[model samples]
Target: MKNSTCLQPSLATTVALPVIYSFLFPAGLFGNILAAWIFSKQAPTKRTQYVYLSNLVTANLLICSTMPLLATYFARGHQWTYQSVVCRIANNFGTLIMHVSMYVTIVILCSIALSQYATLKKNSDAKHSPAANENFHRCVLNKFRQPEFAKYLCIVIWLTVFCITVAAIIRNNILANAVGEFHTCYSISIEAGKFTSMLAASLATACFFVSFMTVLLSYYCLNRHLSKIQKNTCIGEKHLIYGTVKRNILVIQIILTVCFLPYNIFSPFFYVLLPGNDCKKSNYLVEIKNFLNCLAAAKSSLDPVIYLLLDKTFKRSLYGLFTKSIPEHHKGKADIFTEETPDI
Candidate 1:
């Protein structure tokens, strides 16, 4: 296939991508790296969720840190001035990081939903009898005494993503052969390769859609069950449980739908339109594709911000990092103690 005239990016996009990349990449990379460090320092406990969350943060950081490579590529007029091997490596790694990040998020979200459901179910079972309720609460609390299952799941998730990514890299030679005369790196022969591209993108979209639906359905069922319980019982604590769970689930769902859904929807369209017969007409579509690709990268930053907003432990840790001062009274007491103590 004859190469189509490359579309010139608008000044607005040229400016926006770099600015967004600069702010998002550094901040997100730093934040998620800090989060992973913090999580690592803590002794492993039954809190398997934290393990998964940390892994997700690590993946996001990896993705965000690669944005500068992309920015540099675009800044040079979409030319891949880098070596062919480096270009392929960067592209493949960036893509792998993104897929890993998405799947990690999906796993974490599902875990949260399942945890909430189990908690609610235990509460419901306990409501039937005082003795049974106490025992159930004890059992629920004790469940957190072992982190083995969660750790195993996290390992499995990462391994699965790794295998899938390796398979893709092995099967796709386009990344190796698609460099233009100007050395601009792109996927191969879009018209000829449209089927493979579309197939891969469709599978990704389907996975995302399925995970999204799982989250939505789980929340709906949970809420419905809570509502039924609320109608039957007049316990004040019940309201608190429902309110907290509802708020967290709602925020997560909203972010997933708003920040991530557009990329999923537009990506397949971009791939399909890229190699169509109407080259001039497809220019705008290709531009849109590039824009969406950038948007997907930006989600790495957005995910950490979401964690900060929604996860109380993360918020507290971030706050502690930013706020270094102790209370005035405590400081004074410490100073006095130091002065009075022997020089040991």
Candidate 2:
């Protein structure tokens, strides 16, 4: 976003953003490195979740890596003093990391939801058919049960995000108009046309809702199925499974709400609320957007803590590292969403 006099961030916001980014940089760097190391210890091919989680850790690291440049930008009175190319790279990378991390987290939630759905289906089939080993059920069970599937999914996601990000970078740089002595990189300037603003707003709205709806649907389906299972049969591991699913749902809910929801909801408006159209409104919206983006960036710093809290293996490893105690050697497949097999 361009630094226009018509929509300058408040003095407080300028100072606050740098301070927040500075804190996030070191904290996110250390935490994500630890997370990546722990995730890498498990072979991704062996545990499909390890692939998604490993990519998520890397994505967060990328987000964190952009903090220094951002902190500099903010500290320099919210202006870009660097080369245009460097500024573009830093700006584009920050957005890219955010989108990639969000989609990867969505994929993780999908993986968990699909696994639970398959189990529910298999149970339903078992009740109906005396022969629980039916081919149909087996096929359904194995649908998304492959590590290769997850790898391919991640590859596709990365490629798509790369294309979208590159397009955004090109559009922003091409459309930018200098507001003053300092050239603004992505100006919704009076000189620039409305095409870029329209395109960006449309894209932002679509991306936000798609991811939001997916998470909501996944949570709803899992909760409904779990409720049915509990009512039908209160068996061993029932409470444990319910507890795990609920925790996963709540964590994802909080992460998305904090990181993506507010930024996405208001970003389109920020783009369209141009300086020429309404100076006061534009300035207010710009500051609000800046604050929301800062909150979104904080997700990178928070994700490692989320993993430590939610993933048993990660928690144990972290504990052992701090306490200087020998950690238990985990055996077999690490289940991310099951208490029985504790790993992420």
Candidate 3:
């Protein structure tokens, strides 16, 4: 018999994983589901970018829905008592959804940033000419009048994500057979090959670093532009436009830094430093690392909450959820505390 040191999860892991899974599974699933629903009700012409966001939320819900099964596996002493095929399927599905969700989020974040920048540029251009303003408004109206492009983009994104996920699963399964594990799932043994392990670590590190830098640079440029507008000598529509852009950019930056960046920095280090051998202390470290990863996954759920608070449309949807009538619908028409518009 080959000697092996399989993980024996600690009491803390046993307790913590289930608790974390409970919170994550329900919150992520319901939050994303609600986001999708609200998005469906919105004017399709409002923001085509939000269609990508809706797909992201759906992917996140799929990923988080699998957490309970993973938690169950861990609870069973990290053993594969389940059928080998079932284990592989579960693991592959969970991993595929997670990776797809993450990459989709990265793409959507970049898209949203670029879209906002473009919108700002368009607005800036409109300031110079009444003719240009009329032309732009006409274009906007025409763009919204058709829904074909948005529908095609949404379909393409879904199909692309699905194809990539399937390809990864097939490739991993083939690789698993050569690595002496027929029943393996998402986790590749780091000890299988030092070169392979190092390569994986390097790739993960590079991706995280690139994403972090991209988001940071995008926001830095946006903030500098907004600051210039704030310091501008003229006051008018540009001021209101710049203010809205600045506020939205600030909120996005804060979420990326505080909620997302910490986990990205932590994950690669955790994967590299933690050995495959299941020493008691090493297992403890792995548990802590997994908890941090859970925190990272939880950020998807948090993103929509941030949107609800920062974006007026989401807030209106939230209010619509809790109240029979949306307060915004009654704006200026009803007797209320005041006829003042709420600040975004």
Candidate 4:
């Protein structure tokens, strides 16, 4: 993504990114660590969900780990010599890992949506629902509901993403363009390759869209199916299940919209605009791309909070850490969306 002989430090590179990354690093790190600890304490019945969530936490931690190096390079990479090892690790490897982690999270989010939908659909009363719909749901999403299957699925996702990212890195660095001296660290964005960079960006954007649409569809079906049950039931707080599921779905929806959507929306355009552009346009594109990337990284920071709010075990564990008192009324609350009607 080199545009000229040397890039001058802009406010985006020097101030905005460093400040943003500094905030993201510690916040994301602490949040994900807490999430990991809570997940480890989950009961064996939650093994399926633990598989999905554990992988998600791992990805978030990976994203946070890269932030410091990225921030440091942006803050003062220019002062360092061009041959410094920090430059390669910060711009090249850091960016690659971040991309891989982002994609892993995206895929896992989609899996969560499908998994929850299947669980709900299977548990829904069969008399009111079409038999074919239940059969279809079981046929498609039931396998993913198993803990062993989910573990394998996550492993495959990681390996696939890792391979794709490594291939792109090799192609971009070794095949697309010769290694050029970068006088300013700010200009050392993870792009120097031409076609391969575009391919990587396009693939990520495509993956995001597919996952986003899948999540939206899952939410729509769950809402449509569960709303009926909520309406007909004059019994206990069955609505609690509906509410919890609805809120969790809403949280993920918001997270996806806020953190992942915008970056993916505009990233493909950067590669297209990179070629044959003047220095001014190139710099602007780089700034905009990097800024959007920062927003995407914020997903890691936000996911921990999402888990804390929507995941009951995480919330309880966090609460217990601060205080030992447990309320009598809260002693036997039912699992979210699992028990449609508590044995009242």
Kindly give the stretch of ten consecutive residues in candidate 3 with the minimal lDDT sum. 334-343
Q: What are the RMSD figures for all models against the true structure? A: 8.7, 4.8, 6.4, 2.9
lDDT of 1 by residue, 160-252 (tens): 766765566545545534643323453233222334446656766777787678678768976886777667777574465556666666766
- Report the candidate with higher lDDT, 2 versus 4: 4
Against the reference, the lDDT scores of all candidates come to 0.59, 0.62, 0.56, 0.74
Candidate with maximal lDDT: 4
Q: Please report how far candidate 3 places residue 131 from its true position, in Å.
A: 20
Off by over 4 Å in 2: 1-4, 42-45, 77-86, 93-142, 177-182, 185-194, 197-201, 275-277, 322-344
lDDT string, candidate 4, 29-65, tens digits: 9888887886676534456777888899999999999
Each candidate's TM vs. the true structure? 0.77, 0.80, 0.74, 0.89
What is the descending lDDT order?
4, 2, 1, 3
Question: What TM value does model 2 have?
Answer: 0.80
| TM-score of model number 4 | 0.89
* Per-residue error (Å), model 3, residue 47: 2.5
lDDT of 3: 0.56
Candidate 1 segments exceeding 4 Å error: 4-8, 42-44, 81-86, 128-146, 174-183, 186-195, 321-344
TM-score of 3: 0.74
